[model samples]
Target chain A: MKQIFRTIAMIFVLCLAASPSFSQTGKTETYPPIDSDALEQFGGPEGVRNWVESLFYYIMLDNRINHVFREFGNIERQIYLNTQLLQLVLGGNEVEYQGASMAAAHADLGITLTQFNAVVEAAYNACERIQLTYEACNLMIAGLAPYKHAIVTR
Target chain B: MEEAKRAKFPVSKGAALVVAMLASGLSQAGWYDSGKVLATGGVSMIDGAGGGGITPWATITGYGTKEGINGDLHYTYAPLANYTLHSLGAAVGFWDRFELSYTSSALTTGSTFDTVGLVADTLGGVTGSLAGTPINTGIEPFNTTIEMESIGAKVRVFGEAIYDSDNLIPQIAIGGFYKNNKNEDLLKTLKADKAKDWEAYISATKIFFPINTLINITARYTAANQTGLVGFGGPDGSDKEIRPEISLAYLLRKDTVIGIEWAQHGDNLEGESVEIAGLDLTGLQPTLEALGLGNVSGTLTQHESDWYDVFVAFFPNKNLSITMAYAMLGNITITPDQHGFYMSLQASF
Candidate 1:
């Protein structure tokens, strides 16, 4: 049994050592460039600001993730940044996100998967409450999907 | 007694480390010493630290990591008709980079020892002889408690399982466990590996944030057959096999999750002939047949069953959580169609 196990381990180690293709795991994913039409569907800059407020409202009440924002009062800047970021990502040239990158913004916050997922969930729920068309909501979520890696630092 | 004390030294050290981390962590507060997001650190697995029932994943076990430290303690119970398993576990995660964990399990095997003729083995008789009657080792009616301990460590190598919404790069982690069981003498007669064994694994996890879906895959390689449940090694030789496990979870709420976990295992105890744990049943076949029991062909040694558990985990707060799962044990080797329920309570910081 020991000999057989050794042989198997040897094969495994060799496979890992010899397989260069296995190193492709750390690369980032890319999505198609956002178009202006989808941004319009997400409801322009003012609509996005309202949507941000709605999402944060849900986030404040969410038990799973509310603790993270307990001390982060005064989210006016956050709202502004999010609105501009959403507009820019949705193919609108009306606003530009001038804040730090997502990774930098959340690096010290030590965001967790559950918190991240809650944020996404709240965003979706807010979209629902806003009565955006189902397709448009789906599009909005897809548009925000790519920022998870950057926003989640922990 | 001295050896036992010596054996506990490392665990004590680990505990001390946890205490020290906690002490220092308490000095600075208000930023949420728990560090990472709430409920992001999953509850513990049966034999290791991770999500799912039997499989471990790349994610660490707490909300800390990126900033602080995470610690948790858990207890689990699983009961079947012939067996009951009770386990206790503890884990500590630092910076989300590394984790150290320990788990101990006590399993009561009912009416199994007597049927296997432990008395005969103790009295220097043949492998299965008690008062001149060949003991039916395959089917038993005696109960005995078996104890096993496992210590594990894991580290996340690169990438992340969650939060990397745009990254195809799945979170990967490397981990291993050292397990020791007290049933050494009987296992020795069966040509098993040893009283202790090691298993190594690599896991990858990915979370697609938009869909709120998390998928995890893990591959493990080990020589301990049946996860060392039916004993390890066999007469035919024990070979390590790479087993794969997959887990999928849906976020019903931010704090509530329901998931399905499936883990594949290998059988390494087929051995040669009808030797049931070194007690060859060939000699008793005719005798049993004459008694109207038919030739009890003892070919039940190689039964390895995959474990499937559908679990629901709810975390009302970051520090407290509970998991309830229904596990399908498939084939229990000595028994047939053994399934059971599992519930675990976990507290984390």
Candidate 2:
């Protein structure tokens, strides 16, 4: 009987250990700042494309490609993609192109440019809160260099 | 060992009971309202319209300016010389955004001996055999009865079509139903081969409104595949069938609609011998068995019946509506004409 009790207790312990917990954890993680030096390196229209490519890679690593593409059930991802796209363009050279306005460009692409701008500002503010590094800022800048004109012109 | 093997997966009697409850529940609920009398209509909801109401139509209608959720209730009854059928269904929706539904049906079919004396005489044939009489005994009366129930959930992927902003866009919906047919015990009692099967269906709807208030139309097609009915046949040799329907609704008021619909099943059309590679039968028996009915066989022929419904709906608010409808079956092969009436009240946030 004692052995049977021990066996039942062990089985109960194993079952409890295998169960998944549904409680929420209170700890929150902060994101790093934008890489401004990389932004400067990739400044201007020539830098915009590279910046978009880097942002694309970051988003992919983050498992947010569908959000960027505006596919099914990715509204939050779409906002993030639009914001990053705008930050790369505005943060680059101040040359303006003769296409649609940034807002219109975003609209044409099935997103709201105002929303994108808001997201960019929020991201920048968040970076300050975390005291982001200059290297990180520069990396983001460099990535934006390739499509600077496309961003500003739109 | 054989009994143990049978017990291991012996068709779940509990699951069968649950299915029976669901089937009866849905049929009695009667909430889905299809809009057309015989054809399909464009898929869209004008403030009280429901998805079940959308029938197939050739032209696009009800593009834009149509919004609202519609709820429906439906029931069907068939009384045949050999069997009886009772079905109930109910459905609710929100701005055509989401839908939840349930249906249940009970069928009592096969031969019933009205007199005990006749049954005793039939039994006497067996006793006579013991007496060494060479008289041939006639076959005893055999009958089959079946009951099935199912539940489903659906969502609208898109609200409006891209190219035609005025029309209700195509909606993609997916749902599954659990059916329980009660004839398995009868099949076992008769020592006949049978199995209980599950069935599923998927469909799309497009609604069109031409000339605004005068005519609203919709077209819809559904495909169903299922298996497992004791004594009749198994899923291995079951066939799939498509149902197409059309509906037309006339707007009596901004918040009111009156419509008619016609629907047909492709599996058991008139005059078609209901048989598969490994099974043989005539009409409703095989179809019901394919649909998860165990031992229920009826006088109804396979696919020999079509359905018609007339319905009215009233919407008092954006999220609430009430509907009333009546349906009848025509060209029935084995039953007295079937008739049904239903009323449903629904709300969604």
Candidate 3:
């Protein structure tokens, strides 16, 4: 019917309108452009540190991916570096991430898709626990999504 | 900020305690692991498949990861203007790759038998009067519940519908369902060729994270009449034909989605003349026509229509999901524009 087609067309247009806002930060060689509002809600690098710590806390408790985390030598250093990387991901220049490239760092882990999904779930839970806005959490996940190919070897 | 940190300190300590337990070998890994993401296991479909209300998708039916198993039970009900449909089923997902399901559906035909009896009585009266004899052709009311059972299986051939958001390739799967209608005598009276048949379909599903949209397309090959509730094939031994079904959904968040689905059906039973029990209408047509009562041949030709719905699904957690929809099932049997509200409840583990 004409009404059904019109409704479908309207939804398609809305999807198109929302595409650019979520995809603008794709595949950047360096840190993405800072979103000042998101950074303010994050309460700067201190807030970023708290969120990373919360994320690692959940990661260590998750049986699916916790064993992989146990293989790391220094849990505190891993948390510190992840906080710096997350800060850069949110467009903050407060710290530089000194860890290896995502592919190289994860190459030896033999992580499966299941484990990667578990990690993503944990990250989302951490964002929620930190009381981040819904859009901010989605934007953060979108920024990190491209690395799945590199991190998930199987 | 200080208060927040203080509140989270116990959580941090608990994590450390759990890690210490793991270090001391005090924990045993559980057998079942619901590691898949939320809402990734889609809601249970009407036919017990894991998909939208009517069209099946490529995703498996539960929250299990590749290393474990998961299953769920679902109940769906639709109350249309002329009839009501009830479906109940269960499904199991194996290693997140293969799925098996069973569903039993019943359709209650309201006011259909009375209308048939009224037509039969009038024809009998006219023909008997012309022949100088009184005849009775009234049919007794019978059980009007048409029941069908479906057993289905699906295997994921390739691709991933979720978690591979970096690519454009969608998940693809192939599946089939064997259906059996329980009303054998009624099917014979209705001039159907068979009471059971097979329906096979291949589905492709993809989620575009950038737009927060999910799309599923399926091509089904079947000879079923109104999804086999009325029976299968026609009086002419109808061959299986291909039809298309599609579902498009937009994610409001990770746990909720609003969507639309359209499923096309076949017309295998259309234009077929029917034979009512204890009535030979072919012999009475001439007598009725001679009395100027018009031709009284029982030409029971019914047309079927495509089914579509607009739905919203919400998953409060990984264990339970609820879906509500406005369904449009046009021209079912003798009824026109059979539209109504549909609701389904699913519990997954």
TM-score of chain B of each: 0.83, 0.48, 0.81
Most lDDT-accurate candidate: 3
Candidates' C-alpha lDDT:
0.67, 0.38, 0.74
Taking the tens digit of each residue's C-alpha lDDT, what string does model 3 give over B1-349? Answer: 7334533344334334423432332122453546788888999998888999998899988887776667778899999887799998777777789887778898887675554555555655654566656433223465377788777789987776764454545688889877777777667656667877778898989876545678999999988888787787876686888999999998887788999999998786665544554454455557446755344344344668889999999999998999999999987765678899999999886
- Model 1 lDDT tens row, A55-82: 8889889987787776655677777777
Q: Taking the tens digit of each residue's C-alpha lDDT, what string does model 1 give over B1-349?
A: 7336535557546546655665564565642346454556878888758666688889887667565667788888989766788888777776788887878787877764453444333322543354455433332335566677777789887666654444366788888877777766545534465556668888888766445567889998887755675565666566667889999987666577889999887666543323444455455566445544343345323355788889999988888889999888776645656688899888886
Candidate 3 chain A, which ten residues in sequence have the lowest lDDT sum?
A: A24-33
Q: Show the colliding residue pairs in model 3.
A: none
For candidate 1, give the lDDT of residue B331: 63
Task: Tell me how many residue pairs clash in candidate 3.
Answer: 0
lDDT of 2 by residue, A36-69 (tens): 3444433444444434444444444433233544
Ten contiguous residues minimizing lDDT sum, candidate 2 chain B: B57-66
Arrange candidates by lDDT, descending.
3, 1, 2
Quote each prediction's TM-score: 0.73, 0.39, 0.75
DockQ winner: 1
